[model samples]
Target: MQRKFACFGGSFDPPHFGHLRIIESVLNAKEIDKLFLVPNFLNPFKSHFYFSPKLRLEWLRILCKESLKVWADKIEILDYEVRQNAPIPTYQTLQFIQQTYSLTPKDKMYLLVGADNVESLHKWQNFDWLQNNVEFVIIPRKGFRIPQNFQTLPFCAMDISSTQIRNKLACSDFVELSRLIPQPILELILKEINCKKIDKK
Candidate 1:
């Protein structure tokens, strides 16, 4: 049988419940054989991350582990993009996966993106090529509405943001942390933030 794969790439600065929820919803709705969570070393548009790439990768691994306990399916966290020295564009990342996996005509590949990304798809590298290539699995965000012409997955809209989580951690707001993030990922974030504070002092 031809396997269907969904490529979900992001910073995953701390990998919150929102991220996991979206992954779970996608799996529940689609016939996806595997959902590859690719953490980018540096997103071309973003300047930097709250956590290091190595730390973010570790967080992703922890997320996959915890997710399996709940989700119980193919959730593969890949370092394909992070391993690269330069910031690779979305089209190139998709292309590399297509080639590396030896995807056959029968197989299907879909790029999982936020509704916000759909609005700015034209700004991405080789936008035309990307549009012509793989299908997109759009997840709705709080402020962003799904586009009329695009197909979207059935997702519970999450208002969570990595930036908000980082800010809460910086201020040591564990109450908000309990609500927005998973326990394992929250521990990791606290550990890293505490270590950085100790290093500074």
Candidate 2:
């Protein structure tokens, strides 16, 4: 029997509540049977990563175990691009997935993307191949409009992003940060980064 699979790729710089929301959303979704977390070595659009690929992948697995209570069957942390140690394009990533899983044209891989990526999606390397090979599952953002052509996942507007979390780290407090990030991940961040935090009273 053919199984359904979805891929949610991102930096996951510091997996936060927003990421948790999406993770839960996709896994709980009836349309998907399993999910693959493809953490990038580095996003082609970006120059650097605050955390190394190894750490990010480790944290993601910790997130799944501690917070999501997920196992290998439910979720997989793929290091295809990270192993290559280069900013590989999404197109290549999808091709790798397609070939890896023996997916055919009829078995279209469900590709998850944020609303922010919608506008520039057409500009992504080999966008034509993506359009034909996968179904776009749009995770809504505050300002962006999801095109009718794309499928949308239900998400309440939360003005949180990985970029926002990084910026807040230096100048902002963990009290707020604690709420944005998952408790398990937050604890690791506090320990690894040597930051302070307060238990909510």
Ten-residue stretch with the least lDDT total in model 2: 192-201
lDDT per residue as tens, model 1, 1-201:
788999999999878988888888888899888788899998898887778888889988887787666555677777888888667898888888889888887888889888878778889999898877788878888788787777788987888999898788878899999999888888777877778889999
lDDT of 2: 0.83
Alpha-carbon TM-score of each model against the true structure? 0.94, 0.90
lDDT, candidate 2, at 175: 84
Clashing pairs counted in every model: 0, 0
lDDT of each: 0.84, 0.83
User: What is the lDDT for 130 in model 1?
Assistant: 80
Q: Write out the backbone clash pairs for model 2.
A: none
Which candidate ranks first by TM-score, i.e. highest? 1
CA-only RMSD, every prediction: 1.4, 4.5
Q: Over the stretch 1-201, how does candidate 2's per-residue lDDT look in tens digits? A: 557888999999977888888888887774566688899999999999987888898888888887777545778878998999999999898888878878766564788899999999989999998887788999999999999988998777589988888877877578889878887787777676663334332
Candidate topping lDDT: 1
